[model samples]
Target: MKRIAVVGGGISGVTAAWQLARERAAGRAVEWVLYEAGARLGGTVETERRSGFVMECGPDSWVTEKPWARELAAELGLEDEVVASNDAIRRTYLLWGGRLVALPGAMRMMVPVDLEAIADSPLFSEDARRAYMQEPERAAELKATALPEGRDESVASFVRRHFGDEVTRTVAAPLLAGVFGGDVETLSVRAVMEPFVRLEQQYGSLILALRERATKVKGPKKSVFTTLKSGLGTFVEAMQREIPPQMVRLREPVEAIARIGGRWQLKSSRGAEEFDAVFVATPAHVTRRLLEPLDAEAAELVKLEASSAVVAALAFDAERARGMEIPEGFGYLVPPQTAGEDSLLACTFVNQKFGHRAPEGGVLLRAFFGNRAAGTLMAASDEEVISRAREQMALALGELPQPTHALVRRWPFSLPQYAVGHLDRMRALEERVARLPGLRLLGNAYYGVGLPGLMHEARKAAEEALG
Candidate 1:
């Protein structure tokens, strides 16, 4: 049997192994082993249950438009376990000038395609509204001219150019920052949000793209974003159920990986293993260290840069939360420009967004901190982090009630920021990897940082390795 080893037991690693196993079960005659540095299989993707509260350490749900994650869930017989968000409450908040304001309903992320929505929304100032109105007229001239080649611009630059500084700094920047957990000024608009940028290039107007998209009817619009009824951990548990117990080795960290005599050798603190093929699914930095001896240039590219973040889950009585006057929306995101005043980047109203996340009379709030310039915040003590979160919560939610429960989760080098020239860099890296036989790299850094993106990359890597 052909032996294959999958390193890093994260979503990407597990998915890759599972796909390979599926192919093997179809008479490929392949043997597989998965190694995880941590004791648990899911990396960053974790759900904790405490006092009837289901706290998600990483992502709360997956986007349906991506398709890969949802498809995988269905294939695993977990369709019944999936639950969608309350569409009636599909609202997000933005922090502007020390106030939590609802993002305009029709405003999709960085694109303010809905003029009437922006005008009617309370989120922007009169000046901001006037400035945003000029975008369509300004963009018209660019549409008439020849498009630039390899247009590489930051989210801040692109937003400010089309929609004014207020829109960029207050709304666009915060939304992107919350999603990427990185600085908007360094984030590549084309790389991070290609669909929106492409829509603007192709249709000349974001409003037009949205209108066209609205007409397309596919599947139940009800479950756009979904999670397991039990918790996100249910998905992880389901994946584990499909794999043999002996194939997965937890708490086994690989220190080095090198090619020896036409095969791959992986050295871990626990021991060493040999395999015909290998899949690297850890973070870029970790991958860099593991592959340093084998490929110096590949390791260097992997060490470019990544952002760190911390999530604080605070639980309080529902009565106290109601007394604090917290609004009905899911949560609010703070732009990087409002750095000092609002140390928090975003806050998720856990209880309101998902059912059974908190006790019947309890409220759960998850606050995210640290971006590019503020990554040092992740190193702070739990008490200090909680205090900072409370300070921001008080300003956004109006009042701060002492929490009955608080959990601090820190991620060092959590989200990788795809800056200018990122695609070119990835292309070069892919070409280099193609030269190495029976080896593949898969993770959030390549395609996207979302769950669906990771699964897509994993499945693609598995196909390449098996082929």
Candidate 2:
């Protein structure tokens, strides 16, 4: 039998195993094993079930903009189990001056699409409003000049170049924290916000490009995010069910990987094993360590030091929540500059975003705090963590009572922040890895961090490794 070893139990590893499993199911004649260091599957994609509530300690959904995850779900017979966000009240707020202000309707992820929306927003000052409006002419004038191609810059510089410092501080910084848990000044423009940059380059103005996009849209659009009926854990469970039970070695952690005698060898707690091929889907730093002895050059680019993420979700009593002055939207984001040292990143109205996650009449909100600021809370006692969560929620959602239920999940070095030059590094790493035989590295540290991105990498790995 063709022996294959799958290292890491995260979504990427599981998806890659499942893809290879399909090939064996199609009469390829192969045996595969998945090694998970932890006792359970679904690394960070954990969902805790309680009395009538689904508490997600990690990601909640996949943005529908990327179709790979959904397509795979359909293939797994999970089409009927899919659920989208509650679009009717689907709105996001940004914390400004300690107030939860609705993100202007026309903006998408900090890129202002509507000058009128900026004009209507109380969050922006008069100078900001004027600078926001005049971006197109400035961009057009800049576009008239010759610029070098393929130059990379930070997300902060890109936003500030067109939108000004205020936009970067208030909109981009907060939104970047909410998503990547990284400072915008370090995150790469080419890796993260390439589409916006490309649009500007093509049309000479983002406003002009957005105007054309809006004009061409002839009908209503679908909600941008989707999840499963039983929470994200359900997706993990479904994948586990399809994988051969004996193939998954829970509590078996891989220690090192080596390429020896035209085969890949993995040293784990159980001992050493050889495989015709191996996929290391652990975190980038883990992957780096595993490959360092075998391929130092490749490891250099694959090494990504991830950031810390602390998620604490608290539920309010249904009756008590009814009369509270909680913001009536999807919650708000706190910019780093305003949040200061040891500040919370953002607060999410979990129940408001997806009504199914909570019990009837109850309110559930989650706070995402990251980096050194989040580290302080993560190292604290559960009581301290919950207390800080309460304080943050109160500051963002107005005065609120103690939680009827609270959960704190600390994930250290979980999110990989793609900084400037990340793309060039990854490209070089891919080229180097391609030269090696029967080895593949899969994880969010390279291209993307979302579910769609991970699934996309899995598909590519399957095609490249198996085919």
Candidate 3:
């Protein structure tokens, strides 16, 4: 029999262990152990349920375009739980000048597929509108100036190259920050926004590419996001149930990892253990430390800056929620510069975004604190965090009623920032990792930060390690 070790019981690590479990049950002649430092699993993916309300503590849902998470849900016998977002009223608002303004319809991020929508929208100034209108004509120029085959640039530069400063600041920055929790000025265009980069290389103008894409891609439009009816926490629970309970070692942190005699050795609270293969799915910082003794150069390559986040989910009863006039759209994002000292990053109208989140007539609102704000607020009491979120949200959506149920969560250094040239660094890191036999690295620290990406990476790493 072969022994395998999986460190850090986040979604990625858990998924890897689950894959191994499946193989073991099918007579693969393998045994595995999952080590988690925390008391619970799921890392940032968690859900809270109370008073007929299902509030997501971390990620509410995965983007529908990525099938990995949805597929995994199906494999876990959660097929009926899969639900799509309510795209009929899928409008996202922006907090500008202390007022909520709806972004133009038929717009993908900063690029507007419907030029007429941009012209009629109040979100962008006349200068920004002109930039959108002129982008098609400048397609040839953009193509000529596109970065060479193997070069990378900041997301800010890529957005400015096409839509100029106003669009980058007013629209792009907030959208990116809401997802990646980092400054557009430092995030890599090639790594974080690869699809858009490819469009730039091919069509030069993102607007042109999106317009053509709209016409060519023929299908009943899918929802932008998808989730299980019970909540993402159910996904974690289902995965845990499938894997043998004895194989999971909760609260046992991996102190260090080393490559010895072409095998992997992991030292944890239970002392040292040897394995035929090891999968490290911890956060970037932790993984860097574990890799330091094995290969200092690889450690240097994995040293990427990460950002923190804070979430507050407030669930109001039917009567109290009805009294508050919430907007129809999904949620709103606060531009960093416009936010000033305020820590609010974004808020989600949970019921409107997806069904089954709140009971009939009830409401659930989730507030996200930005990276800088999260650092200062992480140490505060849950009441303080909830109060601050409620106060900030009330400013945009009028006086909010006292919530019937509320919860707060803090994730420090969770989102790793993929800086410019991140792809190049990851390429070198992959090469170094390959040199260490029976070792694999998996997590949000490389490739992507989305649920689907992590699932895909974890499954592939598990298969490779087994082979």
Best-fitting candidate, scored by lDDT = 3
How do the residues 1-467 of candidate 1 rate in per-residue lDDT, one tens digit apiece?
Answer: 88988999988998888888788778787888898989998888888888788889888898766778778889999888777777668788877778877888765675655688888887778998887776566657645541355767887787776667887877877887787776778888778878877776776656566667767856656645777767877777888877887999899888888898999998888778899999999998888887688888877777657888788888886666566666786888876776674378889987778777887878999998766424666667889878878887888776688887788888888889998778778888888787778888878777678988888888887777667
Model 3 spans with C-alpha error above 4 angstroms: none
> What is residue 130's positional error in candidate 3, in angstroms?
0.9
Per-residue lDDT of model 2, residues 1-467, tens digit only: 77888899999988888887788788877788999999998889989877667889899999988898899889989998788887888778877787778888867777667778888899888888877888777866756641246678899887877778998888888888888898899999888887887776777667777878878988887787898866888878888888888999999999988888898888998899999888889988788888888889988887676889999988876876787776666778887888866667888788878757888888888888897777787789888988887877777666778778889999888999898889899889889988778788887888889998897787677756766
Better-scoring candidate (TM-score), 1 or 3 = 3
Error of 1 at 173 (Å): 0.9
Q: Which of candidates 1 and 2 is the stronger one according to lDDT? A: 2
* Model 2 stretches with alpha carbons more than 4 Å out: 145-147
- lDDT agreement with native, every candidate: 0.79, 0.83, 0.91
Q: What is the TM-score of each candidate against the true structure?
A: 0.93, 0.96, 0.99
The order of the candidates by TM-score, greatest first, is 3, 2, 1
Tens digit per residue, CA lDDT, model 3, 287-354: 99999999999999999999999999999989887778888989999998788665589999999999
Worst 10 residues of 3 by lDDT: 335-344
> What local lDDT score does residue 360 receive in model 2, on the 0 to 100 scale?
86
